[model samples]
Target: MTLRLVIFDVDGTLVDSQADILASMEAAFAEIGRPAPARTEVLGVVGLSLPGAIARLAGDESDDRLARMVEAYKTSYARLRHQNGAASSPLYDGIRPLLEALHARDDLLLGIATGKSRRGLEALLDTLDLRRFFVTAQCADDHPSKPHPSMLLTCLAETGIDAGRAVMIGDTSFDIDMARAARIRSVGVTWGYHPAPHLSGADRVVEDTAALGRVLDDLLELAT
Candidate 1:
């Protein structure tokens, strides 16, 4: 079989996490006696790693303040996750079916490349019952933030899939840019935090999970 890999972005792609993320960000800012960023500002930094994202939201805050904010954000998010239980950050519509269909295929390998930490990713996968579907998982804990290509490059290496035979599916410019930087094809979804214009750099832009499934099938067929 030709080795083909499909890498997914976690937050805005597979899961609708904006509410949890925004709530936690607000709590984090409150903890430090700082004003909370608006929803648009929070959404803008969704695809980057927590520290980097928090730093951007912090503006001119000192490095120590940024670090404290990051920690507070993590703590707030953890509390939210614990409180939400099974309903935490529900998967987007059609995501489960899409994963099931892809997992059923023999020729394609599945993986995740995200700004989420390994622990955080593991919890998400477990919560969504998605852990068994992925063969390789690369997280911010192991790589530089998105648009740097480290996570995607590591996924390609670990999965033994050449960049030419892989595609990254995501909802943000960071995801598309990361794929581009890694020399792989990228497919963008419109349902993510970023706007469609921001994702124009992607090789293909899709509207929803059903469209996403078709794009994935087409990419693999072309790869083969």
Candidate 2:
């Protein structure tokens, strides 16, 4: 009954930000006279840090040009934020219910560990009315990006929870990598940005919401 923390990723695992992400990315590419990658290709890089994702999207461009593209992306993203970011964004089906179910568990504490800015995450959470589910969060702006484990460590620090008892639920190798680096258990979601096979490092992978709920239940069982 002492499973005190559950940290989640944002882009793919919670809110499906693909529409705005792709639109804004395309706007970035257009400024550089390049084309946006298809949705499938973009999904492959969705979980990366913004700079990292920009690097991949820059392809063979020179450093200076890539930097320009990044600047363009930032400007475009900001403009897009208020106007279109949430227009097509939505919480994954069952996320609210799942959070509600978990929130009712007195021993569990919900939080977020994501490569998004704290303001950006807060905006999305407010849009979806999902902020109440979290008691703590660590966003990319708070620390170095995934695979560094600093964000997760920060979550542990701020929440005063143990890494050994926390479960990191996310959708990409970066997420799993973070969990493993932090020595915490990871649960991968198959429906998100990364394929299940690529999430091999996770303690387990769940196919859907029902399965995810079951996985959480089992983890709590072990914790108790």
Scored by TM-score, the top model is 1
Q: Rate the local accuracy (lDDT) of all candidates.
A: 0.89, 0.82
Question: Which whole-number lDDT from 0 to 100 does residue 115 have in model 2?
Answer: 81
Model 1 regions more than 4 Å off: none
Across 161-207, the per-residue lDDT of candidate 2 in tens digits comes to 88877999999999999999998899999888888898999999998
lDDT of 1 by residue, 1-224 (tens): 68799999999999988888998899878877988999989999998999999988888988888888888889888888888965768899999999998889888889999988887888888887899999999999988998899998888888888889999999999999999999999999999899999999998999988889888888877773
- lDDT score, candidate 2: 0.82
Alpha carbon deviation, residue 214, candidate 2 (Å): 0.9
Using all chains and alpha carbons, the TM-scores for the candidates as numbered come to 0.97, 0.92
Residue 84 error for model 1, in Å?
0.4
